[model samples]
Target: MKKKLIFLTNIFLCILFIRFVSAAGTAGSLNINIIESQCLLDFGEGWNFFSFCRNLIDKNASNVFSSAENNYRYIMRWNQEKQEFDIFSPRSSRNPVPDLNDDESYFIYFYSNSYLDVNGTSPGDESRNLVEGWNAPSYQLGFSKTIDSLTLPIEYQYRYIMKWNLSRQEFDIFSQKSLKNPFGTIDQEEGFFIYSKEDLILNIFNMQ
Candidate 1:
């Protein structure tokens, strides 16, 4: 009887492990140390449009846009909705930074894949925002791997999606996700520390 019980317990533990692994993400997992995050619409075949923004203001240690963040605005041109408005706050930086091991296990979270809102129009200093953060633009996913030791150079990222409900004037808060892209850019390192093509995002975006 005891042997049978032990066998059942082992089976249960195995099932639990499998469940956890499957819950990770649909995409093949990558070990990325995501120091920052952002959001956009996955337009398919590796083309994604900067869509609505999501800020993980909870990470007190995360990179934040300056108080002078008012000079910018994010506009999302959803094919489904007409009256477009600001997607998120420049103050609400979309890089969704999450917690990971102190070492080789940092991970990111992606909420959804559809519905895009382009990066905001900030006319000043887009370069400084590039370094202080890592690059996973939109989720709260946890670690990417398990570290047997204390700390090792870590790399991981996670992101999610957001959409608007046409019926609701206010953003959907989290609904329709329509786009898909195997290739996209990561702005996790922008607007925080390293400075380069500061407004590269705005310059590249051709929104009408």
Candidate 2:
């Protein structure tokens, strides 16, 4: 009877161990889903090095280069002057400056890995912080506010805000000096190069 009891205890322990292993494997696989998910990038805070995808340009290199984690790539940046993309790859001899302006939102691609997981990510912010310099910032026009409806100080009225037409790919001057129609509406997706007289924060709340 004692021998029978020992055999039964051993069987129970073996079953428990198998179940624990199975659960652990399932959890590991779930991490792959997080890596494959899409995340938005906001340039409101500032420009910095970003790893938008899970595959690194150099597969054998250490994960220290990628802030996102192991098996991730640094992706590419845009050249505003050249209107071209500066991509990072092992084959490229010269690497261009990786910087993105607030003028537009970009879509990033990634290589999927079934073995990795992403713990958390920040998509950036809708609002932007500006210093006492030229800032090319874009914000979604909220509530269809007309140019005239927007209020600014009398001193900063003329030439403070420059509106961009995405379709034309050019900026149309709008200021008190130009005497442009204040009733004209600005698109939210369009970028506005604002010349800040002082340090201030620009927030675009009503963006879809």
Candidate 3:
């Protein structure tokens, strides 16, 4: 009778382990039904490297994007200047906008203006320069599931004002990393939207 009980307990544990693994697999899957999907704004074959961003005020690039992961590569390329994008990831101010519009959901970038980023990522003051000629980039500004379920940036100078769509599940940026003093000095401007003006954590927006 004791032997029978032990056998049943082992069987139950085995079944529970199987179910737990299956559930985790389901949660880790990436949903393909994005807000918008386009093949026209291709990333082009192989790896592509860019070098600068046009001023946002030059034109409005809201509502025009490809995907959210790699915003710079999926913009509508016209005249080779590339136009129409949502997010901006600052890479040394070189290729700041990445594309006219960013199709990706997450990244680091240079914003046109801190206040203007709330204007639907339109053409505006775009970048993360603390001082003139100090075009220091706001890197590590994208998403990372490898750390946890879904995590936002873990850097102070990497803020991007995002218009999040819960139902559609998207983050369309209007303004990105722009500040009077990204170096955390008293000379900083009025402060970014919900940001603490203070360097709270290395990585904010861990998705609640």
lDDT by candidate, in order shown: 0.22, 0.37, 0.24
lDDT of 2 at 2: 4
Per-prediction RMSD in angstroms? Answer: 22.9, 18.4, 20.1
RMSD versus native structure for model 2: 18.4
> Tens digit of lDDT per residue, candidate 1, span 91-197?
35562222211111111112222222222221221111111222212211111111111011111211222222222312222111325432122222111111122
For model 2, where is the 10-residue window of minimal lDDT? 1-10
Query: In model 2, which residue pairs have backbone atoms overlapping below 3 Å?
Result: 54-71, 54-72, 55-72, 55-73, 56-72, 140-188, 141-188
- List the candidates' TM-scores in order: 0.16, 0.37, 0.15
TM-score of 3: 0.15
User: Model 3: which ten-residue window has the lowest total lDDT?
Assistant: 1-10
What does candidate 2's lDDT look like per residue over 1-208, in tens digits?
Answer: 0000011111112212222336446532221122222223222111222222211223322232344333334444443335455665433445453333333332223343212221222223345555665555444332243554433332462246665332243455655556554325544233445556666665544433
Cα error, candidate 2, residue 122 (Å) = 12
